[model samples]
Target chain A: MSTKPASERATPWALVTPALLWTLCFFVLPFAAMALTSVTAKDGSFTLSNYAQFFENPSYWRAMVNSLQVTAIVTVVSVLLAYPLAWILAEQVPERFQRLALMLAVLPFWTSYVVRSYSWLLVLAQNGVVNRVLTGSGLFADPVQLANTRLATVIGFVHFFVMLLTLTIFANLKQLSPSYRKAAADLGAGPVRTFIHVILPLTLPGIVVGAFLTFVLAIGDYITPQILGGNNELLMPQLIMMQIGRRGDFPLASALAIILMAVVTVAYLASARWLKIERA
Target chain B: MRAFAKILATVYALLLYGFIFLPVVVLVLFSLQATQFPIPPFTGPSTRWYAAVLADTRLTTGLLHSILVAVGSSLVAVTLGFLSAWGFARFYLPGSAFLRGLITLPLTVSYLIIGMGLLVLFNRVGIPKSLAAAGIGHVVVNLPLCFAIIYSQMGDHQINIERAARDLGASEWKVLLLVTVPVMAPAIFASFFLSMTFSWDEFVISFLLTRFETTLPVEIWNLLRSGLNPKTNAVGSLVFGVSIVLVVAFELLLFRRKQS
Candidate 1:
């Protein structure tokens, strides 16, 4: 392949150039522009005021705190909820039905993301079905406030991420040969012990990957918080959106976005230590 | 005891399924509501909201814009991704691994951050917010996915075929267009389909990058902010319906062929 003619030597470069250039111009350059803008003040002077503002403002820093809390909650809850479901699909369901079950599990993911949150809003509204059910079934005295709260945001995030984590964990569970389980049983380990020691340890990488993905996506998201969360409390994305949408403050927004990116990078590094983070 | 555990597992699975599908069920059921509110009371099933959604020019235009952006961006993303994937697979280049990683670096970043970066860059560069700008952002997000998918599928088998074609005196362009592409059609098509779906449903980038003539998700967001109406549910159900059809069709047409 390296012994190509002079005219053909540049073919690979030509083939790859468009994508490289596109990524450079649209992705890399824009990111560079954003980083530069984050450090520049309104008057075009170099300043750390935008970054400093996040530290000085309790409300702004509170958004970051809120984001981390919500993301951590969503990641942990989704992984817990999804593991059993993934196990059921992988181990209990007949092999022929596994694909269909997995597809059904993730079916709602195809819904427009905005609409997914809105649907949750409708379901959790004062006059919504959940309220009607609780009231009708005598589960509660009245329709509890479910929508337009941090609870609603967490629920929305968890709902989406459960489907996602289930897929990853399911794939992980499927890849495990029956030999491991058989070997555990042959060694006099009970079902619970086998699962606890062998299965759980084997799937930790998949769990970590899915949990990290849930953390990154749930933290940076704006729609679920905006639609389902109402204006009760702000998250990092909501705070960044506020800077741009309300005040047209790009510097401040960039600073917040960089901070968010930094957090995600830290998460990726943490997770990568446990998992190889390889690409085929 | 085993039977009781089995029954419990079945019940758990059913409950989980119910929780997962609850919002979608509510959304679709309310989309057919005869009245104003999309909330409960089990109103008469009617297509009136769907009719209203179709009637609204803003939504209809937004739908077309979404289709255009999704198709156009996905096509470009797939093309560039395929070419680059072939280049790196077929030919050795200096620092290729680093270059490939650089191309895929966007995959780790959040879409909100990507959108924000573009918004600031476009603002400074005086590029007015439009569908094109949004499409560019969509390409940025989808290109890495396309690259990874297509690159992974470019195994030794395809290279062997390409070598055979070249040995048979076929020109480079001829081999790529006739031999390499057909062999990689399934991968290319899969990447294109995935890219289209991502671009179609992408919200944050389109939200930040477009103005008056925005995409459907942005339009839907406006409808949501304006008020809760059955129209939003109707449109949502419509999108869901269309996406399901596409997924089923792809599964049948592509996966079935591959399996056989």
Candidate 2:
């Protein structure tokens, strides 16, 4: 690179300084503060008991287990449900209506996020739509307990993420050149073989990106579990919220948050190769 | 075999669509129930709940607070995002990639964690929880998104125009304001709109940072926790209706202009 004068070098810095300062003061500083608090005890001495509490307590560790299990299930189910729908839209739907179809798919996403979860509560409640249908159709003799269960929580999450994954996977499918299909056919591969060997692998990056997002969001969410999970089991977010909201226990909350962040960081590093923001 | 495959795909798509629309459809339908509960056996198609929502001063005040925070946070986020995006794209800076990564690192972290970190920091610093504090949390969440979107759209085509403006004896500020900003208006608008959408809908940060004077989502959370009422449904349906209008307008005005 050619050497630039002092004024030229200073201009870029001037332009960038406000953002850097904001990120430093708010983002980085807060993170450091949290990390510090996570190690500090309530009595003011530095201790790792806040984190050790997570390891020693059965309920605390159980919340982590529940979070991971639900997140994994939601991610897998959403992707499985979304991929075929994305394929149908990109491959079989007429071109002129594709935009409309895609818009409809994500339209519900514009609803209030809190409302969306509460709405699912209504749909899965004891006297809600599904239960009413079962009883009316004589499929069951009694109304089932659907609301306030892990199943309801999973249903709410999968509903949201299926829409997200569809958008991503649909974009990936559309990016494929028609020639890939033609070449496969010419090389004697049928439609199923071509899709299995060529299309699915090509779209894996999109799937991984969507699934990673689902995992992070679902794992850290408090509302879906707080509203729908019905106190049957605790998730990490709910446990963290309880510490601060009810007990005024900042140290424990901070420690739990750090642990949750560590899990998300691991998920990110696993999917880092496929998650290129510039290219995406 | 081909026809069978097409039939199977059609049935599957319909089922998925049904699943997707079920809750929303139920939400809207029961929002009009004349009865107390927002559940089954539709009663009168009443306007009582909607009237109740409009009459409630708490809900109305919360709506205004939400709009204020969303607009204020989004503006600050977009301005900082646009300037930094321009700098990174136009200039050659050492460790630019690393710095950019640092700025965008929050996108990978959960909102709950970010809210917790801010809560801890604020508690230590004696900064009382308020709408302004929540707005800062929102900006922290949104600044990265704005930066990424605006940065991606700054391409080489705009560079030539900027260089030409400079060679014509325009000042650096003048060239940027007159030439570069004009060309990047589409991206700027997109980022601002997107930021507004996120800040408007964001819940966790606002919930954690605000006390009594809170945003609509927190207020709605209170309402939800209190009981199951058609009033909550009415407020939710109202929000959904307004959001749909804005989204449609964005799609028509911004997206169509860009496409053409």
Best by DockQ: 1
C-alpha TM-score for every candidate: 0.98, 0.97
Question: For residues A131-207, what per-residue lDDT tens digits would candidate 2 score against the true structure?
Answer: 99999999999999998899999999999999999999999999999999999999999999999998887788778
How many steric overlaps does candidate 2 have?
0
lDDT of 2 by residue, B1-260 (tens): 88999999999999999999999999999999989898888876999999999999999999999999999999999999999999999988899999999889888888998999999999999999999999999999899999999999999988999999988999778988999889999889999999998988899999999998999999999999866778888999999999999999988996679689
> Could you give the CAPRI-style class of model 2?
high
Best lDDT goes to which candidate? 1
Considering only N, C-alpha and C atoms within 3 Å, which residue pairs clash in candidate 2?
Answer: none
TM-score between model 1 and native:
0.98
RMSD of each: 1.7, 2.0
Candidate 1, residues B125-164, lDDT tens digits: the string is 9999999999999999999999999999998977788889
Off by over 4 Å in 1: A1-3, A276-280
User: What is the TM-score of candidate 2?
Assistant: 0.97
DockQ computed for model 1 against the true two-chain complex using alpha carbons: 0.89
| DockQ by candidate, in order | 0.89, 0.85
Candidate 2's C-alpha lDDT?
Answer: 0.92
